[model samples]
Target: MQVIKKLKDFRTLELLQKANELTLKNHSNEITLERAIFLSWWCEKGDCAFCYMSTQKPRISDPKKARRQINSILAEAELCRRMGWNIEFLSGGYGSFSTSEIKSISQDIFKITKQPVWLNIGITNDLEEYGEEISGITGAIEIANPELHDKICPSKSLEDITNMLEVAGDLGFKKAITIILGLGETPDDLEYLFNLINDLKIHRVTFYSLNPHKDTIFETQPQPASLYYAGVVAATRIMFPELEIVCGTWIDNLANIGPLIMSGANGLTKFPLFKMFGTRYGKRVEEEVYWSGRKLKGTFTDFNSLKNGADLGELNPFIKRYIDKCLNKKPLKE
Candidate 1:
């Protein structure tokens, strides 16, 4: 109702100000820098009309090539921990790994980092397999309308996506859903999105403006205007006051983040956190976050420690077992 009234006014500045005020009043002045450990770039059915991954369509999706070494993943998790990040997502794309593999990977990372494992590795059908080990699950609903989503992702269904979130929530995992702007979705579609989040008891809402990859079907589509993107973030903040709202950043849209921060985005995602070895990206990220007058949490700090080498478990026996398993020093326990 507030959002609708504000829309009738249609003044971008006022809308953003109200959202900013609401955010500061409810939540404090803080923004988080997110990190993800990629387990695979390969997607089995990479045919979404607007997907950046679809450009890499493989004739045959080999799971072996689709997966990354667990040792590398463990090291990255340790790096994130060293950087003072409480959580990092483990992504393997769609059909990149099996349930057993995911369970094993999640357990090892949790033991090593002591940070709750967040899974963004596409939709997982068997939430029961991971049980209480995994802390969070993401099932991105890029398109709000069922018909539109079906049209864009012919191989998938809204039911499959919603079921993943619902099951995760029921199983006591923090469930997050992503809504991508500039994917042929209108501002009006936010109403459906709001309703879905409310119904699902979603804990977080992530927003991204589509950054089309070259040679993809959506290559010609323009990204949502910065003002429009900020507007979406503002409306989401207004509607979901208690939810964690994160605005995703790409290199192209990095500078436009200030407007998003002011429009009630409490966090920024994909800040090239793993590239801490280079100060260029890190310097710019801190400067931008400070420019917005919000303190940045989880910025890379352990440059020397990461460069040298960080180990996860050296004391605890249980953690050492998982670490050994990830490092291929011992057989994985059943």
Candidate 2:
């Protein structure tokens, strides 16, 4: 399929406007933004060139430490619920936890709060038998181009990722896939991935702009232009009108939010509290205390206080501006 190649083309702008209208029409008045909690801090696939986790060693195994981490996540989930946000638990490290351990953790969380939980703990072959406590499964296929995937993630294969998605679908799990832009991938590569998504009946898609971490291989690489990112968001909506396209909150600049939403993204994934209080436990391979850190000095005291203090509400003005500009056909003043 022919795709939009240029970010500033007149045709691209028109399509973006159309997508914005479509999003408003389908979603009614409010866009559905979601929040997630990182179950752990590091990645098990420790060799991915673009990830900070790749620079670190795997976490050590300790039942006591694991229990504490689980408790912290549950506490945060409760806080998130009180904030009127349905929280998804993302397993940070790779699939270091065994199937039974994963299943038991999900069961524990669900039994306590009875809320939806999402898992992204890397590929586990026996996931289908891991029980239905999880609401969905997320597989981050960072780049659609096979060559790029192989180069950046030398530890994983595209085929394994595809099979994982297929297995998740076969087992009746809602599939959420992540596609990172500015990974040296072309529009055609995105089209190919979208086609695969359509074929697999994936439930949700989230877009992330490549943010090169300091210690990673791509640290010095320039981030993709905001306009290009916005263009991709618009094109994605045009291609999959009914699919839930999420704008990731990890984006550094708030200005990009307006153009991203205007280009038809209907969901935002954020975790301000998680960033403030969360701890990182790498995969099971090193010392238990090897990868643990946080910003605050005390225990989590108040959910409302933390939520209020966060800049999470910054998206509101951007959304309003995008809507006004769309309706009035006037350029939004930056």
> Which candidate's lDDT is highest?
1
Candidate 2 Cα misplacement greater than 4 A, ranges: 2-10, 58-68, 274-334
- Please give each candidate's TM-score: 0.86, 0.75
Worst 10 residues of 2 by lDDT: 281-290
List per-candidate RMSD values in Å. 7.2, 12.6
lDDT of 1: 0.73
Model 2 pairs in collision: 44-94, 59-282, 59-283, 59-285
TM-score of 1: 0.86
Clashing pairs in 1: none
Q: lDDT (CA) for every model shown? A: 0.73, 0.62
